[model samples]
Target: MPTAVQALCANFPDLTPPATLALRLEALMPSRRLPAGRVLFAQGQSPSAFYLVEDGEIEARFAALDGRMSVLEHVRAPRLFGLAAFISGKPSRYEAAAVSDSRVRVIGAPAYRVLMDDWPGFARALMREFAERFEGNLRLLEAARHLSAAERFGVALRQLADERAGPSDAEGWQALRATQAELAQLAHLSRQTVNQLLRAAQAEGRLRLRYGGLDIRR
Candidate 1:
């Protein structure tokens, strides 16, 4: 198998950086292996480095005063996270933790700046990532403003399914590996509401709940 950095670099096939730059980055940056449920960074902490998820999944989450945790984003492999704090020179607004066994490449601010200054491909890739995230956030805001709770739940489920769908069966059903609580957090709904919505969907033959996840019909 390719190394984590090699896999990450492969993601930007159209915006390939120079081999020298890629090698330099690989040499300079450090990789961290996080076990499932390990906290990579905590909310309110200073950003020492931004991360690129090279393997597995990392969840960005917010903790309320009452100890309720809401997931803001589920970042999968070959994606970047923690950039806003790194760029703005501010503390992180939310925590990031490994949702599964994961490996992440840590890029310090100095190295990031150097790459941005020297590598046009790297700079363009970052800009593209930022633009896509900004557009997605805008869509989410619009959904929250206009959609009902059930509608929002459907939207969230579809999004998660798109992101992490397993192999489809002969009947065109795809499995999503997520819990009701995680879905609740993602949809910004209560667990009870999620359960009700899930039951309704199942009753309608839209999905089937399994031991650890759900299978949704296409």
Candidate 2:
């Protein structure tokens, strides 16, 4: 069986490092497994390590004053996160938690910077990943600002499906692993509104509620 680092390299073929570089990365970074619901970091905390998720789900969330938590993003495996605070040299604006049992490779900010400086390929890949995430966030903000509640939720469902879908069939139908509350939070809608939209989609054959989550059909 392949190691977590090896598996991550294989998963992101475009970002794979040469053997020597890969070995160096494995030596520099350490991997950990977290149980579901584990708080990886809290909002307003200072950054210590940036994580590259090797497996399972992770979410970034912001908690409102009334104790409501809104999800900012759902991250699947072979993805880097918890970097914005590290890059800005400031406290984190959101918290990260394990949505399921997860494995991740962690490197401190100083070491991460050293790796980027020493490996051009790694640096470029990291930069590209950051740029793509920034663009996605901007699009989400636009949808929230201009789209109707139902339309915004439609966008959220599609986005969740895309995130959870396998690489070979990303555009195909998939199940959502999130709860209705999570979905509502991400879409900026109330749970009652989310339920209404989901029921409407079900009537149209776009979604089906399963025991675990919603089964969506594209």
Q: Which candidate wins on lDDT?
A: 1
Q: Candidate 2's residue-wise lDDT over 1-218, tens digit each?
A: 34645755654577655556566666667888889999998999977888888888898988989987878898877778988897787899999999889988887865586567765587777777788887777767777899999878977777777667433336455666767887787788899999898889899987778776877767
Name the weakest run of 10 consecutive residues (lDDT summed) in model 1: 1-10
- Lowest lDDT block of 10, candidate 2: 165-174
TM-score of each: 0.83, 0.84
lDDT of 1 by residue, 41-142 (tens): 999987889988888999998888999886777988777889998888899989999999998888897668767886677787888887777676565556
Colliding residue pairs in candidate 1: none
Model 2: number of clashes?
A: 0
Residue runs of model 2 more than 4 Å from their true location after superposition: 1-4, 167-172
Pairs that collide, model 2: none
What candidate 1 gets wrong by more than 4 Å, as runs, is 141-146, 166-172
On TM-score, the leading prediction is 2
User: How much is the lDDT of residue 162 in candidate 1?
Assistant: 61
What do the candidate models score in CA lDDT, each in turn?
0.81, 0.78
